[model samples]
Target: MLDIKQIREATDFVRERLASRGGGEESLVDEVLELDERRRRLLAEVEALKAERNRVSKEIGRLLAEGKREEAEARKRETRSLGDRIAELDRQVGEVEAAREALMLRMPNLPHESVPVGRSAEENVVVRVFGEPARHAFGPKTHVELCERLGLVDFARAAKVSGSGFALYTGRGARLERALIQFMLDLHTREHGYTEVWPPLMVGPACLEGVGQFPKFKDQYYGVAEGDDPSNLGRLYLIPTAETVVANLHREEILREGDLPIRYCAYTPCFRGEAGAAGVGTRGLIRMHQFDKVELIQVVRPEDGYEAHEAMVRHAERVLQLLGLHYRVVLLCTGDLGFASAKTYDLEVWAPGQGTYLEVSSVSNCEEFQARRMRLRYKDCQGVNRHPHVLNGSGTALARLYVALVETYQQADGSVLIPEAVRPYFGEERITP
Candidate 1:
């Protein structure tokens, strides 16, 4: 959430920065300001009414003490009228405050100054490329073809059980998925200084709101209906990403300056509604209703936010580097950035069989945007409370990486060679039909 005070003080500057997004986000500045002004005016009126009510009450007491019962009754009647008016003003204040908050919640974070100005993914700038896509004399098979030939995934059965945009892994495919999850968890926890956490798959509305996922992208998530079970009767949503859970781990918390930077990684089966994306990249594992992901989250001092963001991007890149997958880092343009992120870097891995690069991860620095929403703060050395910056990135989404691995390591005989990094977890890794 943006600080309304900042918006009020620097309206033009805020609007200019948000204009780069080009979605009329700049126009929200005026709406928010108008609502805020109305709220303040209502609050001021309520305060004045309350002050008058207090003065009348004191006069009523004085009149009664002096045995002026009639005078006291008249003052009491006036006080009752003032009280009613104050109650009406208080209601108006509440309504205006709620409207202001709703508008603020819908507003996207302002892009960082360094973010490139562009209108779409086409304008995203590639920062670096790693390893060339593997070449083969024989044409590479798509993950779907390879998995089907090797009896690894059963898309047909998955469709029958859960409809399309879902996969049922069989035999080595299931084992490979498990191996990847363990490998990522171990890598992040052991080598990257991240604390591993296992969080709930379902969260309530406040949890989603705290992470800036509610009110704006609500349609993109699966919501759990209220059930007879007492514990489950509320507005619950299946987590779209582990970031939603891990980011709220410290919600409404105040930390010491020494603990300025807290890093956590979690593995979860993400669920997305994917509403309105019918037929776009729905084939294979590129897009799915249910997918596995390992997410990395960091809460750091404001000064260290950009540094932590860069480190997180490298941490995600390291997963690809260790697996020998060809990938590139892209700096997202303002228009292409996520709602909660001030800046983002997308890691796109080359898919030989698909003949394209698919996004495997997005690392973002949300600065204090999420922290403000979650009320996550830290006490500085001088004991002043301040909002900390929050950052999250996928160590990698398992489905796309699975696609890259299968296509990159497939042999002409239709067998798949597993990468050395995960061989120990897979036991004997050259999966053959």
Candidate 2:
């Protein structure tokens, strides 16, 4: 939520920003300001009325003590009417304040001044490209084709069990997925200074709200089935991302100043409904109902979050770089960015068989958006408490990373060369039947 006072003070600045985000009424800003003014004025009026009532009550007390019944009676009657008026105004003030807050929450965070002004992902500027897309002398096999031929992935059985878009990674395929998870967790925890934390795979609605996912993306997430209830309305849902849980670890609590920058990493199987998605793009592990991912989350001082966000992007990119996969870094445009993120950097890996760049990671700097909702704060040296900035990035998404690995490294003989970083865990260089 925005500070109403700042919204009032920076109306023009806010207007320009809302315009850049696309169509929205500029009057919405005016509305917030107008309601804010009314709310503040009513508050002051109520305070004044309360003060008058207090003064009158004291005067009445004095009158009664002196046995001046008539004066005391008059003062008491006057305050009775004032009390009724205060109650009426108080009701109005509450209603107006509630409306103002609803509007404030609907408002998007103002884009950073340095952010590029663009409409869609097509307009996103590539900051850098790393490694070259590998080439196959013969027709390259897609991960699905390669996985099927090698008896590695079992989509036919997965479909019978769950439906399309889900795959059963058997033997080496499963081991490869586990290996990648271990590799990422090890790198992030040992070398990159992140603490390993295993958070709940199932979390409540409040946790989703902390990451600004509930109200906007309720459709995209999977809610837990309510037992014996006709409507599947329940208190909890399968977590869509570790971000939902890890970011809210300190929700509603104040952290010690010494723990200013907290880093946490977790491996969890994420579940998503993907309600309206379809077609070739949504096939295989690229989009799934359930997939495993190693998530990296950080809570940092406001001054350090942007730098931390950059480091997070590099960390995600390093995973692909180590795997010898070509990828590019994209700075998301306003439309392409997530709801809570003020800025987002996406890592798209080259999928040779698919002949496209598949987004394998998104590192976002949410600033204080999630913190405000979670009430996660830290006290500074001056004894001032403020929301700590939060950031989360996929250390790597194992499923899609597996897609890139299978497709890019597949040989004409139908074997996959495991990356050196994951080989120690997988126990071999070649995944052959």
Candidate 3:
């Protein structure tokens, strides 16, 4: 959540910043200012009424002490009327404040000044590229074809068991998925200095709101049915990513200065409604309603946020480097930034079989945007409590990464060669169907 004080103090500045990101609202700032002004005015009126009521009460006491019963009764009646008016003004103040909060919650975080100015993914700037994409003498088969030939994934059965946008891994395919999960988890926890966590797959509305996924993106999530359990009653959604759970670990918390930078990695089966994402990358593992992901989250001091963000991108890139996959990093432009991210970098891996690069991870610097919503704060050395900056990235999403691996390592004989880094986990260097 944005600081309302900042918006109120520098309305024009906020307006211009939002406009640069193609988020121009002609009267958004004006509405906020008007609501705030009304709230303040109502509060002042209530205070004045309370003061007058108190004064009248004192006068009533004086009249009663002097044995002037009728005068005291009149003053008492005036105090009651004053109290009623104050209650009405207080109600108006509450309404105005609620409206302001709703608008603030809907507003996207302002892009950092350093973010590139662009209107779409096409305008994203490529910052770096890794090893060259592998070439094959024979035409490389797509992951779907390879999976079918190898008896690895059964899309037909998956559709029968669940529906389309799902995959049923059989034999070596299941093994590969498990190996990749363990390999990525080990890489993040052992080598990348992240604490591993296994969080609940379901979270409540406040958890989603803390991560900026509720209210706006509610339709993109799967909600749990309300049953007899009272605790589970309200809005509950399956986690879209482990980031939603891990980033909220410190929600409503105040950490010490020594705990400035906290890193956590979690692997979870993510569920997305994919409400409007019907035909885009629907084939194979590129897009799915249920997919596995290893997510990375960092909470750092404000001064260290940008640095942590860069380090996080490097951390995600390292996984691809170890796997020997050709990938490139693209800095997301202002218009492409996520709702809660001030800046972001997407890591796209080359899918030779698919003839295009697919996004495998997105590292973002949310700064204090999420922290403010979560009320995640830390006490500085001077004992001043301030919102900490939050960052989240895919150590790499598994489905597409799995597709890239399968296509990149397929042999002419239809066997898949495992990457050296994950060889031990797979217990074999090559997977021969």
Candidate 4:
């Protein structure tokens, strides 16, 4: 959520930045301002009525003490009218505040000044390339073909057991997934200085709202129906990413300035509807309703936000570097930015078999957008409370990462050589047929 004071003071600047997003939220400024004005006006009226009622009560007490029964009753009637009026104004204030908050919640974050002025992913700029895609001795097979030939994943049975967008890894495939998770978790915790957390797979709607997911992407997640959960958490929904839960671990918290930067990493199964995307790139593991990902989040001082952004991106890039994968980092254009992110960088890994680049992670700096919603703040040197900035990224999504890994390392003789970094965890991981 944006600071209402900022919007009131710098309406033009907010409008211009939101315009760059090309999401049609620039007009929201006027509506928000109107509601804000109404809320303030109503609150003022309520306060005035309360003050008047206080004076009238004093007068009524004075009249009753003076043995003037008729005057006291008449003053009491005036007080009752004032009370009724105040109550109505209070209700109106509540409604206006709710409306204003709803509008603000729907508005996407203002783009950072450094973000490119573009309209789509096509306009995104490539920041850096790691290495060229590896050359193959034979016609490379797609991840689907390799998985089938190696008896790694059972797509047919997965479809039968669940639905079309699920995968059941068998034998070495399951082992590889576990190895990748452990490897990423260890890398983030030990070297990247992140605290490992095991978060619940389901979260309340407020958690999603705090992360800028609810009331917009609400339909994209799976919810546990009323009776499905024994605990009955009021229709809790499956987390779309570990960030949905991990980033809000400090919701409604106040931290000391010394603890300005806090890092966390979590591995979780992400669930999404992927609505209407079946016609796009639903090939193999490219898009799935359920997928595994190691998510990272950082809470830092406002001035250190961009620096943390760069560091978090590096933390994600290190995973690919250790895996010996060819990949590139791309800066997202304004229109391509996520709803909660002021700026974003996507890590695209090369897949030899697919002959295309697939996004494995997105690192972003939200710049207090999420912190404001979470009511997460810290005390500064000046003894003032201020919201902190939030940075988040995927250490890597195991599904697409898996696709790139298998397709990149497929041998001419039909075996898949595991990357040396995960060899210790995978335990002789040349998944031979």
State TM-scores per candidate: 0.96, 0.94, 0.96, 0.96
Q: What alpha-carbon RMSD in Å does predicted model 4 have with respect to the real structure? A: 1.9
lDDT of 4 by residue, 1-433 (tens): 9999999999999999999999899999999999999999998888888999999999998999999999999989999999989988888999999999999999989999999999999999999999889899899999999999999899888888887789999998999999999999999999999999999998999999999998888778887877656676546899999999999999999999899799999999999887767532344888998999999999999999999999999999999999999999999999999999999999999999999999999999999999999999999999999999999999999799999999999999999999999999999968898
**lDDT at position 61, candidate 4:** 88
lDDT of 1 by residue, 60-114 (tens): 9999999999999999999999989988888888898888888899888899999
Worst 10 residues of 1 by lDDT: 226-235
Taking the tens digit of each residue's C-alpha lDDT, what string does model 3 give over 334-415? Answer: 8788889899999999998999999999999998999999999999999999999999999989799999999999999989
Which ranges of candidate 2 are over 4 A from the true structure?
A: 23-27, 230-232, 278-282
Error of 2 at 430 (Å): 1.2
Could you tell me the C-alpha RMSD of candidate 2 in Å? Answer: 2.0
Q: Please list all clashing residue pairs in model 1, or write none if there are none.
A: none
Model 4 TM-score relative to the real fold:
0.96
Best model number under TM-score: 4
> How many clashes in each structure?
0, 0, 0, 0
Q: Write down the lDDT of every candidate, Cα atoms only.
A: 0.92, 0.86, 0.90, 0.93
CA shift of 96, model 1, Å: 0.3
Q: Tally clashing residue pairs in candidate 1.
A: 0
